[model samples]
Target: MSRLFVTGRSGFVGQHLEAALLVLPTADWQLIESARFDLLDPASLDAALAETCPDAVIHLAGQTFVPEAFRDPQRTFEVNLLGTLNLLQALKRRGFSGTFLYVSSGDVYGRVDESDMPIAEHLMVKPRNPYAVSKVSAELLCQQWAYTESWRVMIARPFNHIGSGQNESFLVADMARQLVRIKRGLQAPVLHVGDVDVTRDFLDVRDVVAAYLLLLEKGQRGEVYNLCSGVERRVSELIMDMAHLAGVTVTFKQNPGKFRRAEQRRVVGCSEKIQKQTGWKPHAEFSETLLSVLSDWEVREAH
Candidate 1:
């Protein structure tokens, strides 16, 4: 059985990836349990590597929350950038030469012009926030390793991926959760929202997992791929769709606190690179994905 080492097992995407790995048909993958290891502690990473001796690794561990990164930039760098370096060093010491997939974010492409509606992988990154900065740093680190080492390393810059179990810090999930509460009579039928006028390219978490799996098998080493739907969707449109699914007439109330200071008014990423290379494209129906998230929140709120 192929031993697959994964980090960030507790995250939303990680959870979905675990579920997918369990039921995959082609390979007998023995997923190394994502034991709680401190990335900042080099010893722990080394010990884990020695213990697992994995054939492949999907690096998803990092400071993911943007606001939290703002609050603690030092810790964010220590984890996202230094933590990656530590892992690579540990792997080198262990003589590990295998496929390593580093999960990056589309946020690295901070702001794009309207002419660049669908941002490609070649676009120069202009990271605005601490979180995005850390990701870019880590991406460079991974690329450097791929260039110098024999290990198969690839990067995936996933755009706004949404699904069940996403943190409420994200606007989409928050709106869906609030709608559920309103439907259950736990709150009034008014939606507290941010800049709903913006547009983004959203890929479902399930599709994201599929792309990762395909990349694991077919992706070229040292290459970076953008995982997105390539469809521009308005935030206001999503809110309306969720409200319709939740069977609630929501009056919108703009909340200043919900807005990001440097929010990109329009953001959409091109998935052509991954599609062309790995033959991976988003397949989930938008409406069906929305309904599933709503249903997931309903269950969570019921308890």
Candidate 2:
């Protein structure tokens, strides 16, 4: 049995990853989480690494929310950048050299030109926000370790992933929740939104977790792969889809507060690298995915 340690087990993707790991029939994986260690607490981290000495690690623990990162850049940097440094040092002190996957955001490729319709790994990264900047910094840091040490370090830049348990701070979840409320007559038949004209690449959190596990087993060391569906979806269309799924007719209202700083107007990513190598691509149907999200909100509202 291979011991696998994963950070950020409390986050949305982390939760899904944990669930995915639990049901895999092909491999025996002993999953370890960060309940006993703090990323900033090197002593605890060192002790934890010494104890577990995980055969592989997926580092998903970091400040991911853009607006929150803007509000607290220092804290974001401390967590995303310094926290990763601490983990690396702890692993080094423990003489641990294994596959280390650093989960990064597609936001790092901020402000891509429209000509670059489907972003690839070779394109230059222009980070436009604190959250994205911090991710890029950590990506480089982990890549550096991959080059210097024998660790199989890989970086995954996942695009906007949506699922049942996601909070309303994001676009799809917020719209789904609001539509659920509108269906239940808990709120008005109106949707408050940001720039709905913008487009993004969406993938199911189920598919995203599958890709992460595939990468852990088959991904090339010292390389970065983009994790996305390769389909550009407009936020307006998504809102419409969710409303239809929730059986609601809604009017749109502009919410100025919903706008994020340095928000990319359009995003689509090419997962060809991961596909050709690992034979992985998104398999969830768009409408089915939306229905699951809507059902999630419906169940949440029932409680």
Candidate 3:
């Protein structure tokens, strides 16, 4: 049986992917958590790859804070850029010939004007923030690796995917967490929000993982694919959905202090290439996802 290796196995997406991979009977999957290989440590990474000899390496470990990236570009670049370089070096040292799946973000295509309704995979990436710049750099590194050494490097630019295990840093999860407190009367009924008018493409974490698995199995080499729902929803709509899920009337309190300096007004991406290439499509409804997120938080809060 084939073996699979994954980084960032403790993160939100990593947790979902790990659970999803457990049901696949074809491969004996192993999650090499941060303990197994620190992205910053080259020797550790090399040792892990040499020991596992995985058929596929899903690179998901990195710094993932947008606002924090702005605060400390050094840490952002160090973690996102240098960390990826270390992994590439480890793979080279191990002479590991396996399909590599790099989890990129739609943030790399930052601040597209309103004219560009649905951004395509071929559009030029003009990152507006430090985090995005680091991701763009990582993608370039992956491309260079593919052209020079490997042919199985696939990049996935997934839009806003949210589900269980997401922390309070993200908007959806933040809202859900706050709603839980409000519903339980632990906090006020008023919800703090920032830039509600800005729209984004949101996908369920399960669908995102399915797309990643499909790309791992059938995606073409040295190509980038977008994983999105091809639709935009305002943050206000999401907050309202969470409120509806909570079955409580909630008030909103817009805090300009909470807004980021370079917030993109509108963000959306087209998943047509991935859909056509691998016959993969998103299956989770937006409402169902909202309920699921709320329910997941509810269970955690209850516990």
Task: Say which prediction, candidate 1 or candidate 3, comes out ahead on lDDT.
Answer: 1
**C-alpha lDDT values of all predictions:** 0.90, 0.90, 0.87
- Measured over all alpha carbons after superposition, the RMSD of each candidate to the real structure, in angstroms, is 1.1, 1.2, 1.6
Candidate 3 lDDT tens digits, 21-85 = 78866535555433467888888887777655677888888999798998999999998989999
Clashing pairs in 3: none
Question: Against the true structure, candidate 3 has what lDDT?
Answer: 0.87
lDDT of 2 by residue, 1-303 (tens): 888888888889988988887787875678864457778889988777666688888898888889899999999999999999999998888777889999998999999998987999999999999999999999999999999999999999999999999989988999998998898898999999988999999999999999988998999999999999999999999899788878889999999999987878889999999999899989999899999999998899999
Q: lDDT of candidate 2 vs native? A: 0.90
Tens-digit lDDT string for candidate 1 (120-180): 9999999999999999999999999999999999999999999999988987889999999
Colliding residue pairs in candidate 2: none
Off by over 4 Å in 3: 25-35
What TM-score does each of the candidates earn?
Answer: 0.97, 0.97, 0.96
Q: Identify the leading candidate in terms of lDDT.
A: 2
